[model samples]
Target: MAKKGHSEEQILRALRQAEGGTRVADICREHGISEATYYIWKKKYSGLGLSELRELRQLREENSKLKHLVADLSLDRHILQEIVQNKAVRPRHRRELGRWTQAVFALSTRRVSGLMMLNRATMNYQSRRDPQHALRTRMRELAASRVRFGYRRLTVMLRREGWKVNAKRIYRLYTEDGLAVRTKVRKKIARRARVPALRATRPNERWSMDFVAARLIDGRWFRVLTVVDQFTRECVLLLADSSLTGQKVASALSQVIAERGAPMSITVDNGIEFASKAMDAWAYQYGVQLNFIRPGRPVENGYIESFNGRLRDECLNVEVFFALIDVRDKLERWRRDYNQVRPHGALSDSAPAVFAAQWTDTAVPGPEPVPDRTGKPAAGNSLEILT
Candidate 1:
């Protein structure tokens, strides 16, 4: 009824007329169209009315304008903002970019740095920092435990436990917080010469012994027979008293053998007590080789000699024994503690007992290479003489 491809409103109006019993041919002719066109319009726009078409057209026009207006407005705002921000920090532009003005004001006086060395220059400024309440508590705990750790060591410890920090930072914090260790710096004593080369890697391979003398409270002299495991630095045997004869020494050694087993070789200084026939017979019976140091050369038997020095410094200097019984008791306690608790730097801070446990026994030579009378290498002579 409507023109070809007619508007939805016109088509709907035509369909309404047809439903009211108007002839399809008459409706088509009234609309300047054909009968087939009227029927097609009726079928397509039977439900849609004139008001719905007007509403949809108005909505589409309004939506299109809204999109175009939003796009133009956004572009204008971005250009204006960029131009304003790019302006110099002059009095006129400062008001528009207030935050930038503040930043310029703060850093304007700072000099341009070309070769600034931080921490060693005038510009090195320290900011006020909040103290770590947790680290202070931990340091106090370590101190109470008598662990004796320095700031660097403490920093390492904290790092091991997942705390992020630097040693110098920790040290500064320590001094400021009064958590630094207040220890008396004793004079650095010269290190003693190292023990002679025994190179005993196996247990019961080489045993070295020496005598250490000390005075009791009554001024009575007492002697300590100190024997050590050369590879381990373990104080295997310690006997107290000067009345110990060669026979007594033998008996004491026999007792040690009964407990810890006999060594393959026993080395000692050429003392009368050790060189006697009684000692020689004991060595033979026990299948232990007896090696004596060169006469007038105490360093040749240095393993036991070094042990004596340590024993005096750690134990003998700590107390005044009133009697042999007191000396014996103290010696026993010291030996156990030394073997189990005291850390040996030579053994990488492990106790002798711990070191011994970790050691894999190997057959070490009898001694280092000893020179012959003509200053030539002695045949199969393992003892070395340091001239």
Candidate 2:
């Protein structure tokens, strides 16, 4: 019906009239078209409507564009893959590229930069940064004095001294100055699958113990035995001494057990004092299971380890202990507050002592009941005497 190259929608609409029983010759004559063309359209798209024919044409065009885009990407990937093979530019490659740029003086700067895949400004500009000579000198002084300190430690010390510099920048300059910390190679140990230990659902069900060390004001080193309840997160005991053997540790636990009752299980590391015969005998006597963590692994007993870190940070690090009596007094006060005052998130924002007391209160019955009054009319009724 329409001229050639017009939308298929127009032709399909005209053909619909012919399909309604109008003579083909008359339809073609009225629509200014030939019978041969009409027949070609009917053979190809007799069952299709105008919308379907238009959609089919759009899909063909989109498919053609997608194919061309995929081909272009493949060509680009191949070209980049062979770049290294074309030239084995190694040491002094930047210098070589610079010379090539100068040799092509007749060419435009943009054209030469495009060929090299570099920016014109990068090729022309020179850095004006001041080499931090003073900072490097100070870092060397600290590193030399403390041979065991690494770059990260040096960064901390620098911050303490009011120097503002980042670790990345210091590390680059440290390497350029040939200042590297010596590191020890650790031997790899074979590991075996281990059964996971059960978590305690209530206080006294499980307890974790670990040791912490600190120096007194007079530089005398002392150790503290830290025992914590896994369920309540309460510090049950703190034993401090200049020297604590397996027997002494066991003795301390016995006294605490005698007062508060024995735990169902005790979690500990594979330290000599914990794995000794003294501890084993105590465990057997009390009928308490001794759960030992894997060799060289402390995360299995994470509760006591976290508690020990907090003790070191909050008490051991801040106070300067002058005597063993002083240590006892300070640690006892802190432990009391830790259990009764400090709120533990794991215990629903209540203190460990408070949480444990709640369970005990629920378990035990309340005070004696009061006597019941029966066989009486309600209150405020007065009976009349004989008149």
In order, candidate lDDTs are 0.69, 0.75
Give lDDT tens digits, candidate 1, residues 259-308.
Answer: 77677777898788998889988877776788887888786777888788
Best by lDDT: 2
The lDDT, on a scale of 0 to 1, for candidate 2 is: 0.75
In the range 103-219, model 2's lDDT, one tens digit per residue, is 644445565456557567765656587888999999999877655456766676677579998888778777768888766576887888877769876567789998999988999
After superposition, the stretches of candidate 2 with alpha carbons farther than 4 Å from their true spots are: 1-196, 364-387
Best by TM-score: 1
Which window of 10 residues has the lowest lDDT sum in candidate 1? Answer: 109-118
